[model samples]
Target chain A: MLDEQDKNVIRELQKGLPLVSRPFELIAGRLQMSETELIERVRSFERSGMIRRFGAAVRHHDLGYTANAMVVWDVPDGAVDEVGQSMAAFKEVTHCYQRPRHPGWPYNLFTVVHGRTRDECVQISEKISKKTNIANYRLLFSTAELKKSSMRYFE
Target chain B: MNLDDVDKKLLKLIQADLPLAPEPFREIAESLGIEEAEVIGRVFNMLEAGVIRRLGAIFDSRKIGYTGTLCALKVAVDRIDEVSAIVNSFPGVTHNYLREHTFNMWFTILAESKTKLDEILDTIRQSTGVEEIISLPAEKVFKIRVSFELD
Candidate 1:
């Protein structure tokens, strides 16, 4: 539902804000608007739930948290919500969601855990399993990150 | 680079919302009892060191009417590099990774509609000669927002 101006502002923002004392000042100037107007627009976007967050994208790998694993679990269809909520409550788990299960892939719940080592990640997953009481799971660790970038909504 | 106490504090501060004030960095400096110049300098250094991926607004993909799926492909080991290149060529493929599994390649592709997503996935399968791709689209999101606290 965003208009052209909103899209333009978002596109500019995805490129990243100017690292000046007043970042919005330059952004607003470029967008042909006042600083106050630009901030207001961003606030409205947040209010409308379009802008989920406006913050720093930290590089967890650089923060000494080297371990990362995507743990997928096969919870009963009826208990998916309960198990998913329980899994998401843990601090180590960052993203938890219920994804579709194909014929061969019975995993319905997926959670990403980060720690200092593989053992730490496994321990966290075990804790989640004990809490959720779902044992059918698998841990997939990324060997390489081929690409990681914000999806560009506009050219 | 090692992160000193100041850098850690700055990272935590900036990870939350940057104040909407005209002098937002100055506001952060005041909160941390540091000079505005020091905040700017540290942020610049962190960006160069890749500690901060970006400073921007994150939009809700679904709210924006874009659909996406997390796809796992059992690509031939020798063909992984080429298949990854083909997948990455599509603008919709935002994240492509090599994971430790029979389905070694995993990536998320987003498009304006379900049809477009299917078309792109089909093209990838044909080009890579991969028979099956386990496409796991998110049915329900229990949690997504997370911020790492650097202690």
Candidate 2:
């Protein structure tokens, strides 16, 4: 429903967001929209589900929770449901879902476990296996963080 | 989505900082020069519309004692639904993606501790028999958060 000009304005804002007091006001001034109009659109986008959520993307390193790891599951075809569902219930598990498989490695099911220390993560993983009773997975620990982004939408 | 003068004022305040106060509503209301109820009303509307998914801290896993990674798996075609249910069971994995490629099952997990993260991955491998799993962890976060211009 937005015209090209409106979209452009938002696009520009997306590129360079100010980290200051009254950030929106500064954006509004550049976009030439009354602060009110911009807020309306943002609110609308969020309501429509286009904008999932709005909040700070915290810095894990600064927070002192700096150990990260990824674990892959080779769940049985028939028992995927039971296993996946049970994995979703873990408190430490944050993002859990399925994807298509790759070659030479067919372990498709995946889940992430987090803890204050490596030992804690291991305990949760063990507990998950015990509860599900279906084991056959691999741990792919991240040696590097390639790209972390909060993609620009309007532009 | 009617934006009156007052609603504009309310939004400007929160856009700066989500209420971190005990009576966040009161502080926001005062800033907008409106009643506390008015500010809450606008927030409620946004939430109902899906504009606001949540009002909480978006933690950085790597910094917050979480050793997280993005792992892609080769899942069986017929077992997509079943696989989703199985994968969603873990809490560490908060976000994932569905891409079109050999390593199709693209997912992520945020683990609290390293040993536990390994264990979780092990569990998955034993369960799925995925062809190959590759992880691309973030090394340098070029840009992590989206800074939206409400205006």
Candidate 3:
């Protein structure tokens, strides 16, 4: 568990690292710690899996990856793990997860696929279906991004 | 802005992780065989172009004692903007989108606890008066990596 000071470090780091020759030095100066201490703390966080990633958050739309689809599949309960891992191996799939199926919603496996065009997204989904042999699926394309912001933890 | 080969390479490098060094950019410059200033300048330009949303640490909410869930609401066509505004007002509500489906508005919310998550969902339901909100919590995460290869 992170203490108050660790939370403070996270708050500062999440705002983003300064673009400079010695970015960590500047951040550590503000955090009232040595540069080495700050780096070590971040490294520890990375090692402990607290920090999922520590780098650029690229906007896919801006990068011409405008076509994004949420492809949900109804994989057999026992085969979900196998099918999910197979689908996740594709470079096009960014996020893949297994969620509980609702009364009316039969799809339990979800994967968010990104492509440059709508047809490209469809092709990727088709490819995944072919590989997984799970034909029961539906692609829900996002019409608009109402909001897309990083979670501000400990705020 | 057109991205040259160097910018593409620099982006790919920065997308992974900045080196844990006194001068991280300098380390990156060494790998790419470019001046540190060039890297900083390219990143600045990319930021201006909105190619890079942010450059920071992405914490695992679960590891940090936070609970998150994806929800889809069956909202009426005319109420999208108003409903979205209400949903987006909350700080915990992130990645809200209007998808092409019956349950049009889909979003992911992260809260400090499961109770907090339920509270937020209840509040959103009450505020929007949209009864058909389905909360889908992940039972297992197969993959959650986002990296765009600039070819």
Candidate 4:
């Protein structure tokens, strides 16, 4: 149960915090609240899991890890937790998930692998496959990123 | 263009959590034993270079009462651009990508409800006229709520 002020805070935060000596002061000033109150609210948000994380969203591609692939696996339902945990242990595997499987879509587990080259990405996936022993998988390399933006809940 | 040790250190620090304070950058600088201005300058440079997409709060859509699904479409290669634009037009579609697979176009849509999410997906399918579409909702998020370590 968030108040209007909290929503306002979230809306402003969704855009981004200012890069300044006192970002919360800037935001708190705009919201007409004390800096301590605003900071406490933000801390509460983090504790309540409203905010996943509060920091820089680094673009991995710009970090020189251009090679990226969404590797989807058809892991056995019984072994999904075990395999997912195994795959997620890799340093390059950033996002791992258990998505529902449709009729034509047999792949249920997905993990994002980032590397310097396509070969590197494939090699990472191969290593994960060998480690997890989940052979049925597809490396869906991104051909083009048409749109990539954070979800705007308040706006 | 490789990052110097300082830049690497700054990046590793910034990627996770910035101290919630009057001067978060200064706190980061203190940890690294660098000038606050230097920390700010490097972050700005990285942002300008597209290394840091944005410095902000990352929210959990589910916790915020948003329902979403990952959709894949086998669009024609020639119509990829057109279809992508149509998909991207929806504000709910946060991520749209052309992937190397039979289902070439993939995107994630988030809405306030399951009904709204389904409606958005239906609208995209109706407008795009792409019959072959697959919607994969998250059954279980085994490893979300985490960030990648830059070290």
Candidate 5:
């Protein structure tokens, strides 16, 4: 339940902000508030769960790692927590979550993995499987990127 | 975004590929039976409306030099925002969120090197004052990439 002023502050800050000295101050000035007030309001929004974060995204392919994949696993409801906990323990698993399963999509627990090559990525997945006792899982690789951006709640 | 049919069409098309031609937008317009200006207008409109958050390329981190992993911070509910701010401060970190469960604050980072990664993690932990931060380095990679849908 953020008021309009707070929302205005967020709309500008969400995008991987300009790499400047006073990033928060820039948005604050735009919102007609001082830097302290702006940061406080933002902290409130975050504390209230209205704003998730302020972060940057790297240009992956430009760096040379290569393969990235979505690794999904069908763990039992009770084991999902345990297995997901174990999976999250691995630095390679960029994202791990419990998603609703579709009729054709039996894998409920999901994770994203990136590696230098397909073989290396698969090897990492296998290691996760061994650690979590996740004998059954599927790796869905991205053939192409569609859209990737920070969600704009204000819009 | 306040997208009309034509704008939606532009989104559907470039939502995937923005071709290699010099005047790619014009080519897209020709294919769509519309003018180049019309295509540009729609795309820009989508961008302004925030339907198109960014008009650029997405990357495959592994294809690049990013050597990193995902980690979850078991932050107290009261300190979630503080932890998130610290995590987000680092150039290496991206994608931070609050989800249900003990390790509530989840985040991902693509470090240039292991030493850099450790430095980023240590700095975040010290800044956030959260010793419970767990760095889950991916022991394996299974699959990656999301192919966009033009349809």
Candidate 6:
């Protein structure tokens, strides 16, 4: 739970830190607080797990990572935890989750894999499959990115 | 933009976490054995080239009292544009993509509450007139870190 002041800090922080020597000082001035107070609040948020990460959001596509695939697997319900952890250990697997299975959608475990080429993505998926022994899976490659933006909470 | 060795090292460091201090970039520069101005210059170049989409805090949606879900919708080939436009109109929709599958359109949306999430989904369905929409909420998030090695 966040008070109004904390929310205000987050709203400004989300816009991004200024690329200056003393970015926090500039932000603190706008929020009507001291630089030390602003940094302390941000550190507290990170410690509390409210701020999951505080760093650069790199666009993988621009870094020559053009191949991206969402690999969905139908691991046995009893072995999902073990298999999901194994899948996540791969450096290529950026995101892994156990999503609810819908009607006609038997896949429960989802992993987003990225690579420099389509073949590289396939090879990584095969490696993951061999490691996890989850054969019932399909790869859904993204044809187009319609929208990709961070969530604006306070606005 | 071509990334030199220094740029690669800097990207990897900044991708993890910027130091929480009065002069955070200076700390990064000290560790990288470079001047603070050089570090700032590289970051600025990457931003200009669209390599770094943002440099800021990433909040945990659930921890922050928000609910989110991933949805996939099946649409006729000709109506893909119309259906996707309706789906992407909602501010809650953070990621919308056209994937290659029967359920061709996929997106992830976040809302303040479960009710609000469902209402947004319902409105998208009604507006698009697409009946085959499935929402797959995460039962367990095993991992969600996205870090790329530039080596």
Candidate 1, superposed: residue stretches over 4 Å from native: none
All models, DockQ values? 0.82, 0.05, 0.87, 0.75, 0.02, 0.88
Worst 10 residues of 2 chain B by lDDT: B140-149
Which candidate's lDDT is highest?
A: 6
Docking class of 3: high
Model 3 misplaced stretches (Cα beyond 4 Å) = none
CAPRI class assigned to model 5: incorrect
Give the DockQ (C-alpha) for candidate 6.
0.88
Name the runs in model 5 displaced over 4 angstroms.
A1-155, B138-143, B147-151
Clashes of 5: 33
Give the higher-lDDT candidate: 1 or 6: 6
Candidate 6 Cα RMSD (Å): 1.0
Which prediction has more favorable DockQ, 1 or 2?
1
Q: Listing every candidate in turn, what is its Cα RMSD in Å to the true structure after a full C-alpha superposition?
A: 1.1, 15.8, 1.0, 1.6, 16.2, 1.0
Quantify all predictions' global Cα lDDT against the true fold: 0.89, 0.57, 0.91, 0.87, 0.61, 0.93
lDDT by residue for model 6 over B18-46, one digit each (tens)? 89999999999999999999999999999
User: lDDT per residue, candidate 4, B1-151, as tens digits?
Assistant: 4678898888888887889888999999999999999999999888888788889788888877888889999999899888888899989899988888888889999998999888888898899999999998888776763455555
- As a TM-score, model 5 comes out at 0.52
**Candidate 1, A22-112: lDDT as tens digits:** 8999999999999999999988888888878887888898998998999989999999989989888888889999999888788999999
Cα displacement (Å) at residue A106, model 4: 0.8
lDDT, candidate 5, B102-123, per-residue tens = 5566677777568878888888
lDDT of 6 by residue, A1-155 (tens): 78999999989999987999999999999999999999999999999999999999999988899999999999999999999999988989999999989898999999999989999999999999998899999999999999888899967
How does the DockQ of candidate 5 come out?
0.02
What stretches of model 4 exceed 4 Å from their correct place? B145-151
Candidate 2 — which residues are off by over 4 angstroms? A1-6, A9-21, A153-155, B1-151
lDDT of 2 by residue, A36-146 (tens): 666666555455544434433333332334554456677777766667777876666754656445556676666766666777767777788788885776655544342
Residue A44, candidate 3: how far off, in angstroms?
0.1
State which docking tier applies to candidate 4.
medium
lDDT tens readout by residue for model 2, B1-151 = 4556664455545544554333556766776677777666676665455444444333334532457777777667786666655666676666555544555566677775678878988877767665466665643231232222333
